[model samples]
Target: MKSKLTTTGSRLNPSQRPAICLGMPLYNQTRFLPQALDSLLAQTYGDFNLFVSDDSTEAGPGQIVNSYAAKDQRIVYHRNEYRRGLIDNWRNCFELAGEMDYFAWVGDHDAWHPRWLESMVQILNTCESVVLVYSQNVNIDNNGGILDKKIKPGISTLGMDNTRRPLVVCRQGQGFGNMVYGLVRARALRQAGVFPRVMWPDVILCIKLALIGDIHQVEEKLWFRRRTDRFSMPRQKRALFASYRPWYFKLPWPLVNAWMLTRSPPALAGSETGPQRNLRFNLAAVYFQRWWSKFGGGSWIGSPHEWRRGKATWIRKLKKFRTAVELKSK
Candidate 1:
């Protein structure tokens, strides 16, 4: 777990800060590591440290990190005792950021604009209520230029602080929450209790952070996220998680959401407008699809509605037709 830096009763004084730490976890990412590192080294903000924990099966990863560390003193290299998979590697990255005033995550395949860190830290210094800062981002290809400008989504929950609801529902993101768009306050990560055991690590963390305070949108596109065939959350894991009820609401959200829920004010609980209803409803749809697949195409009762062949039963007939087509294709 990541701990907050304390001086007085609150978070550490920002004026005394030396450098922001940028942390990343790498696993067999030799092809993309160099570009990611170069992006960081090319940052207009010079006062930052890059910590990399290598979990690659081969020495190629360590050698790449070492090559950078040799040339740039800001880069520090560490290898795991054994292989820590995705979640642990990221967990340890936040934990190792104990001394940093602010930090952000960088994936081996992700790149950033030269002004990324400089803009986020400046926003952090000015906004006390903003625990998380994110901006528009461009999605990039392997060569590290803009692939598409449209992948950047809005930070949909930005002004939720003004609403009077225990629950808040959001559509797709508008600005941030693009995985790598965040440059988070280190204290807030500790207070938020970091990422939990969720299928979407960045979304869960960003949601928790939003619950505590507000988000600052920089408007400029600084963060760049990578998308490819191999990089994804497994469909099975996503489907399984979608099937569960909003267990967080049963108790405090600490078990399911982050510590930010329990410690912060009551605003984030989703009781205000229709946020709570939308959450469960959205999750239900995701789960419903999974259940259909698991039960072999439809309800396990085996089309009891088929007995009543009426005009309203049109959906059932369409489903039967689809199933027949699938069987034929096999």
Candidate 2:
């Protein structure tokens, strides 16, 4: 079994580097920790390190980390005195990452196919513009039975698409720019600033990483996102949605509008990958449109779903774009 630790805390060189670091932020993943560790051990990419931050109360989570660390020095484990929640746990995981040429993260309940790293890492090693890579993960049940596949778009999007090759992203009618398939870069991540203590740190970090290079999507289901209720769906969108739902959302619309107007940078309101950047920029515009229609005024039709019917008949993936707008309906 390959270990998830880097023996020497060195960074990867430009050419054929020998290390990859997988930063995994976990809470009380005790139910699936063993299996998750098993999957990491089976990864085809050999040299790597795993830094795990456990926010699980009691010693259960710590024991799981210790058991794995004892066997594999690459698995560095740390248990927090108190729960750091999602943002802090993931932030600490990245901070603990050793010098790495490539970087990725796995949810504690998520399992990866053996070739997950081998495939994505190879692409990053060869592609100059590519900063991150991820695959179409299979959503599964607790016992590891496949439940459903992640439905992705048909064509390359401006700021988005499903797991496949490195490309910019796009938004269907629902909107674009929130692609959280775990395609990330160590350099990009390091330079992008730390993940904010927000709901969707993953999404926020991915957005910043996209600004650095093209995020390649690998069209394989090597990553298994277990839907056991501990966590489902990526933290990006859900976090943002949650952040805006508090009593503060009830604050004066004029004040909310002013915050965006005052803070946004004119040069870059999006990603670095040209197309994806534009997609992200416009997607935010769509979100704003809906916000104003609801919060700012009362008459804006951001119904990409209804608009999807306007698109050509051969597109089904536009539904994912529509999914983003469901909140508006409620």
Output the number of the lDDT-best candidate. Answer: 1
Query: What TM-score does structure 2 among the candidates reach?
Result: 0.65
| Every candidate's lDDT | 0.60, 0.57
Off-target runs (Cα >4 Å) in candidate 2 are 1-15, 154-183, 230-287, 290-330
What is the C-alpha lDDT profile of model 2 across 1-330, one tens digit per residue? 011211223334657574677778776668888989989988877688888887776678779889889999889887776666666666778778867666677788878889987877766666556665667567789998988645443222223332222222312211112234354666676665546443334434554454456555566667777877642223432433423354544564434432332222334445335655454455445434443323312113323443445432223355656876896787
Compared with the true structure, the alpha-carbon lDDT of candidate 2 equals: 0.57
lDDT of 1 by residue, 1-330 (tens): 111211123333647654588788778888887988998899887788888877677999899999999999998888988766666677777777667778887888878889988777776766566677776777777666667445644543344443321133222333324633477778777655666554444655655565456665677878777764443223423332323434443442223333323333243344534754454444334333322222211222333233344222456677789999999999
In model 1, which range of ten residues has the least summed lDDT?
Answer: 1-10
The parts of candidate 1 lying over 4 Å away from their true place are 1-18, 156-181, 230-330
| TM values, all candidates | 0.66, 0.65
